[model samples]
Every structure is written in structure tokens, then in C-alpha cells.
Target: MRRPLLSEALLDTIRSRAGGYDASNTFPHEDLADLTAAGYLRAFVPVERGGAGLTLREVAREQMRLAAAAPATALAVNMHLVVTGLAAIQADRGETALDFVLDDAARGEVYAFGNSEAGNDLVMFDSRTRAEPQADGSYRYTGTKIFTSLSPVWTRLATFGRDDTDPDAPLLVHAVVARDAEGIEVLDDWDVLGMRATQSCTTVLTGVRAPADRVHRRLPAGPSGDLFMFSLFAAFEILLAAVYTGIGRRAVELGVAASHRRTSMKNGGRTYAQDPDIRWKVAEAAIVQDGVEIQVESLARDVDELVDHGPLWFPKLVGIKVRAVEGARYVVDQALRVSGGASYGSSGELGRLYRDVLAGIFHPSDEESAHATVANAYLGPLER
Candidate 1:
């Protein structure tokens, strides 16, 4: 077998601290620090640039491994990896738009995805923020972004907005801003039911400036078949799915352990592990997790190998995300049923897994969007 990309000891340490961080509702700063020091943050960067240069598929599998140890930590780190992964995709294809991202990653600058909005159904196709263009080719972005993971530690934030000042009305402007730049405020309001350790606080961008060099791409409003867009969607969805799938894997493991440790009084000292119902639940959860694992691995590999799905890629990508997330939910729920009341406690590992899996529902191309994408792919766009 090949050696794991991350050290087992490191993951064990992260797993040990996950509960404490989650209980305190604090960001996994220690995990981030350790990962940064160990260069896991640069896994997607080129080896020539002082990074591991892991392929998208390798990184996705590693994320699944990391998430099994610490869900919130892996989820938070996914934001940084997503940015770097997208840059790596572009660099691999000979694009220069993400050169600055590569340079910054080599210099140990952690990146965060800050493009999500509170009420914007447009997702990445459009933005609610304002990008006021400057004479020097820079832009000042003013808006609010929700779910800014790694909010406390990220050095650079990749953001986007609408440039309505142009007569065209909806230019999708993209830029990367420094976290400490003026007009940037990180609100300490990340109180949530699950994935609490991510500290994905709300960010208020009040005229935050992105200089000309950092401003990467500008496109017309609505989705496009751009390579960069594909990279972003692919990386984001695959890694995000990997995280929840890991949660499901962990839940299944916990359920199995619980079943073995728990004795059934009705069976005269027999373990729950011997109970037919418990066994069935465990098997169901295991099957769901296995299905997601396969989908995540296959899709990630296809992306790395540049398999031409053409117009079908969007539906396929979104389909994996939806399947992985929903499959995880099923696995966790079944695992909880197998483990019984012990998992009901908020501090229990299974309970934490339950809450963490719920967050997968909120990621991009959510149930409605994903279904619409698939429906449109088969039925064609709807008429007004």
C-alpha cells in the first residue's frame, strides 16, 4: 500500500483535539497551525513551488481521511485547499490568472473562499456585492459574505461582486483581498448547531480594495463553461463531498464500536453487535458510505485525468455532491439508530457527526439547485 499523504500521528493528534474545540465553539487554530507547519495547506501547490503538488483526486481522498479525524478542521481547511486546487488546475492548463495565488501559497499565505452570500440564489453566477472600479484597474468590493470559513486565520480571501457601474449592468468581477485590509470586518457571530469549530463567521466587506494584479477574471452575469469556473465548481463540490463522506465513515465506525460494546438485556447478555437489527443498520450505513466513497473517488479521478464529459460535467459534478451529502445524512441517521440513545448526547462523537453532516445541505448547488441542474440537463432549460 502507498504511504498516506498525512501522517497518522498528526491525524490522531487532530482527532484528540476535535472534541475540545467543538465543545468550546472555537476555530481549530491548533489543527490549522499544525497543518500549515507540516505544509498540508500546500498539498495542491506545485512541488517546485514548495508544496506537495498532490493531484485533485489525491487531495480529495486525503480530505476524506482528514475529515474522519476532525470534521470541522477538514471542512475549514477545504476552503484554503479549494482556492489552491483551483489555481493548480489553472496552472496545469497554462493559465496565468492564478499565478499570484500560487506565489502566495508558496509564501505560506492561507487562502479562504469568501464568495458565499446570505440571500443570493445566483450562487457563483452573479453577486450581490458591489465592485467599484478604480482608474488604476483596481476594484473596491463592498458587501457581506456568510460562511467565511477559516475566518480567524486566513491571510487572503478570494471574493467576487457585481460591477453595475458598467453600462452592461452585471459584470461578474473577481478579486482576492487581504484579510487585514481596510474595510474588512470579521464578526464574532458563528454560533451554530454543528461544525462549530470552523468559526465560519460573517464578513462585512466595506469597500475592501483589490489591486489590479490581484483582480483575476471578469465575466458577464450567469454561468459559463469557463475552465476557471469548472475548476472552482469541481474542486469545491468534490472536496465538500469528501468531508461529509468522511463524517459518514466516522459515524459508521462509531456505530460498529457501540454495537460491540453495548450488551442487550433482552438477549441475556448478548451484545448489540449480535442483534440482527443493529447489524442491518450498520450494513446499511456502511453501504451508503461505500457508495459515496466510490463516487467521490471516481469523479475526482475523472477531473484529474481530464475526461471529457462536456456539457454533462456540470450535472455529473453536482450529482456527486448531492449524492455524497444525502448519502452521508442517511448513513449518519442509520448509524445513530444503531448506536441508540448514547448518540443523542450533544457531546458524543456520533452526535457531533450528526450535526456536522447536516451542514452539507447548505453548500453550493443545494438540493433544489442540484435537482434543477439535473432536470435541465435532461429536459432542457425551462421557458418563461
Candidate 2:
């Protein structure tokens, strides 16, 4: 299939100042502006709501290309898209959120998802982040969530937590909190190894009142109420795959360009690419990326099919996500290895690729619950 133009454009921008960006640890604001102008936000948002309304499969493909160009930016943007998809799914809340997102895009308002909590028992969903119901059905949210990406620039946040009462609610509500809410603070505490531009700072919630409409499903809002956990969770896999693919491609491309200039060990004058061993290594990187693309494509298709069928095929999505993340790591590692010491050099492109790929392992996207879903799908049917 032909590559998308968005990927090429973003890559061009990234390449222009990649070394400087990484060295300075700066967000690709220009690239983000371009992406926004290019209607990338609408790429995953619903078409009915002024977005491109691309299918699940198409969304994956598009995001893969975008991520390959700038993984950190792509990933940070995925946070918004995930929440947008969640907003798209809720009939009552979905339309309203989409309208606001469209306005934000029109007004150039950036957003990010803030879901993880600090010191609140994430396991039990104890979510110390409490939201007390107030008069007129509004809620006053209080708690601190760390690792909130793209703040200051982010005008909005999509957060998840249990209600003041009824932890066993039929659904888990995802609320949208404005940045200027009465008692919220955006803390700068992100010290990540890679994808540094993500700006994953901490966002504190203290006595911030969110109206009922802005509050998606209230506490006791069961887990199954939001398919976004499954949808964008699946889409994030595509993003992960794309990030490594881009890194691998850049590494191989740079390696090929540099290898020809290097003297070969086998012969006094032969260059690295001229030697069989180095040529094989470079070729292997290409082969690995090709394989990963196929896997990502298959997963996207499975997800799209599930969207049409509904519920029964969720297991396949989870499995594909696990495999995609694994594929991304493997692909990038091979590319880095083939590129050799140049990849590790402070000035080289490969060094950045190494850091970006490492971020995948630490991302909360690869949680144990998702892994268990894959296991359950494969093993749960055995007793039957």
C-alpha cells in the first residue's frame, strides 16, 4: 500500500530539527500545529461530528504513519484521540464532546488524557480521587493524578475514577475537566527516558466542580459502559507499532547512507554495505519492519471487523495489541543494531530511536489487565 502523506510531512519536520529537539527536550509545537491544521485530530474523531470519520482500520493505518514520524508527539496526540473516541461512543455525552472538540480544533485548543492516579489504589479502583455530587447534579472532584500528558498546552483532560459512593456502579464514568477548573493544578514532574516531548506532567484535582453533562457516566458507571478502553486501547497498539517502524526506517535509511562511506573489514577498500554481513543486517531490519506492518494491518482489520460484529471479538484486539508492542521493540532493536555505534552517538538519529522504543515498555498502555484478556480469550474457551 502507498504510504500516507501526513507521515512524510511530519517526518520532514522532525528530521529538520530532531537532534536539537531531543537535546533540548522540547515538544514539536510546530509539527503539532501542522497536524492540527491538517485535521489530524478529526482523523480519529467521528465523521458525523466534523471529523474524517475514518473506520477503525483506517484510524490505525493513519496513526501508524503519524507515530512513525514523531512517536512522542503521535503518542501525546493519541491521548486526545482516545478520549475523543470515548466521547464518540457515548450517545448522550459523545455528541456534545465532539462538538466541543471540533470547536477546539477550530480554535486551536490542545487536549490530553489524564487517567492514572497517585497513591490511590489503582488495583481496587479505590481511586482516592473522589467526586462528590453537588446541587444541580454537578460534582466536585478532588485527587491528584500523575503522568498527565500535554498539559499547559492541553485545554482539557479526560479522567477516569470511581464515584463518591458505589464503587460497584454499573459503569465507570470518564469526566472531562477543563484546565482552569477551580481547584486543579498542572504540575511539571515528568522525567521520562524517551518520548520526552510528551510533557507527561502531573495534574492535581482539588475541589474542581464539573457539571453533570461534562461528567460522562457517574461513578458506579461500570467498566463495560465505555468501549473506548477497548477501542483506543486497540488503536494505541497501532500507535506503538508506528513509532518503532518510523525509528527503524530512519535508522536503516541513515545506516544505508552512512554505511557506503565506511571502509569494509573484509576488503581493504570495500564499504560496509558492500560486505555481505552488514548488507544482511540492514536487509534484516527492512524484513522486520515489513513483518510488523503486516501484523499491525491484520490487527487493525480484526478490530474493524469486531466493531461491526460487536463484543464477541474483543479478545483478538487485546492479543494483537500485545503482539504489536512486542513487534515494535524487536523491529527497532534490529534497526539500531544494524546501524551500529552511530546510533548511540549523541549527534546520531539512532540514539533518539533507541530512547523512543524504550518508552514503549514503560507506557501504561501495556497493562496486565489487557494481557489477561488475551489469556482469557485463548484459554477461557478450553473448558467449553
Candidate 3:
């Protein structure tokens, strides 16, 4: 957290390049280049591996700070860290490979996702693609993944699929695949209103083979006794909320700067900022943003404290995730209203934030499953 030092200079870089990135609908390659070179992406790897080894709170803070600058790059980097960290843990890839990832992190290598199938919402694990085993322990993977964030730019990817050998296995198989492989096709198909700079596209895999060791198994439950099994979902929710909050904060910051520089049309007010109505709107926006931030941060803080000292409570974490999503929706609505037409324009990061903020309600981590989880915990056994 202290290490990144996200200064005004860093923010200015993001602001300076944001327009160009949004205009091209291209990846925030320049920003990510800075993040990687600065080792921002590797800050969470264990300290034993020479990482900054920040806590969940620290991760959340840095994610928001960077996301405040450019949501697309922040989301891309966050996706990479989540994927690589999951793969790195449990020494899944014979320890040596995971070690290599840590080393790569130390050296500034970033990652991405290649798991969303066309017509398949990433939230459902049952939406598995094909992976057939070969004579070797390895398997040949053939499938097409859509909307893969950071795919074209990142060297590594975490892809989900089903094993042909275990057709009925109640598990989702996640494989760590490289960006460059024979028969792997990257499509230039991502053009959206939000998170446009992520360079998300369709990636087609045609009989690509990777060692079975490269594949990792992700079970339905978190490791037993690990409150984080449920708590991290809360953390993810809070972070998304934080992302929205940061966007709101940036909208205010940009709006304030513009108001001082641009005069109001009504009554020839000295500046848009001086009108009583404009002043009231900005005040209202700040209050709403601050309230949402406090609530989300409190939820995250409570979840962390519970994980460390409170009783093992699953429902609480689920509730936090649900509420965090709610806060995001409210804060984003306020941001758009406060920023006005300027935000909707493609020239600023506010519109990009608008696009990514809506995802808070639908991202696999925050929406539908959470409602069921919380309901099951509080409502008791179901009737047929």
C-alpha cells in the first residue's frame, strides 16, 4: 500500500492517457506498463517471495486508487492478480510453476482471464468447455472463450473447463494457459461502453495441449475452517463497491475542476460551481459517495475482523457482499447525476466508470448466487 505511493503524478498520467485509451477502445497498455514496471501487480504475493505482501485492506485501497484513474486497467490488473494468486496457492502446479509465477510477478509479468464462453455467463461453473486427455497426463483443450479481459495483453490466463474423463465430476477445472500457443486465436471483438480499454475479446482454442499439472481443481467449498472461503467473496464485493466509490470520487473531482473553469449558462453565473443549485447538487453527491464508502469499508473491516477474531459466521459475509452490491448501484447513480452530460461524453473516464460500475450488480462475484447463499443461511431448510 505505502509502496505504490499513488501520487498526483501517477494520477495525471492516467488522466492524460485516459482519453486516448477510451478513444481507441484499446487496452490501457501505457498505464499497465507503468503498473508492471512499478511492481504494483505483484504487491500481494507472499513476502517470503519478496512481495510487498499487503493485506486485503491494502489491496482494496490500491485497487481503488488505481481504478479511480482508469477502471479498465484496474479491472484488468485485479483479474490477473486474482487468477494468478489462486493458481499460485496450494502449490498446485508442482510448486515449481507457482514459484515461477511469483518470480514473474517479481519481474513484472501480468496475467488475465480466458474463461468466458460465448452465450455463457461466467457466474455458472456448469458452463464448461471441453478438455480431453491425451496419452500423456496432459489434455487437449478446444473451446472458444468470449469477453476475455486482458487476454491480448497479458502473458498468462486462468481458464475454466470440464474434463472429458470425469464427465460427471462435481468440480470446475481451472487451467493456467499461456497467451501464445499454437491453434490459439485471439479475436478483436471487444467494443463496449464500459471498461473499453480492457481489450477484452474472443479467444479460440483448437486442440491445444497443456500438461495435466498445469490444470488446477477448484472445489465448491472454501478450504475448511477458512472464514475467507466466504469472507473473500465479501472482500470482492466491497472492492467492487470501492471501485464504484472511487469512480464517484473522480467524477466529483473532475466536475469540481470543470465547474471552476467553465461558466454556467443560467444568469451568466461566474462559474458553474457558484450557483446555489449546482452547489447543493455537489454537496449531495459528496455526502452520498462518502456514505457509500463508509458503509462498504465498514463491511470489509467487519468481515476481516470476524475472520481474525469473531465467530465463524457465513451469513454475515454473504450479507456484506449483497449490501456492497447495493451500495455500488446507489453510488454510481449519484455519480452520473452529479457529473451530468460531461460524464456521458466519451472524452472522460466517468463514462468508462459508468460502464464498469453497472457490472457490480451482475459480476459473477456479486449478484444472484449471493442472494441464494444469504437466503439459505437465514431461511433454513427448503421444501420440495
| Maximum-TM-score candidate | 1
Ten residues in a row with the worst lDDT in model 2? 86-95
Candidate 3 or 1, higher lDDT = 1
TM-scores for all predictions: 0.98, 0.83, 0.80
Q: Please, what are the lDDT tens digits per residue for candidate 2 over residues 1-384?
A: 333436565667855665665677777677677878777776645556566666545655666666656667767777776665444433233335345554554445566877677554332234667767778877777778776767647887777655645534533455677777888888767767787777788888888877777775543432342444554465555555555555555555666776676785659787777778778877876787677667767766655554453543455554455555666666666666656676677656667767877776655435575666556655763355
Off by over 4 Å in 3: 1-5, 85-100, 121-124, 164-170, 218-239, 255-280, 295-329, 339-344
Cα displacement (angstroms), candidate 2, residue 353, comes to 0.9
Give the residue spans of candidate 1 off by over 4 A.
none
lDDT tens per residue, model 1, 179-264:
77999999999999899999999999999999999999998889898988998999999999999888888888898999999998
Residue 194, candidate 3: C-alpha displacement in angstroms: 1.7
* lDDT tens readout by residue for model 3, 264-305: 667575886786776776677667667766766666555434
Residue pair clashes in candidate 1 = none
Model 3 local distance difference test score? 0.62
Clash count (model 2, backbone only): 9
Choose the strongest candidate by lDDT. Answer: 1
The clash count for each model shown is 0, 9, 0
- Please list the residue runs of candidate 2 whose C-alpha ends up more than 4 Å from where it truly belongs after superposition: 1-10, 46-48, 88-107, 118-126, 167-171, 219-228, 305-314, 367-369, 381-384
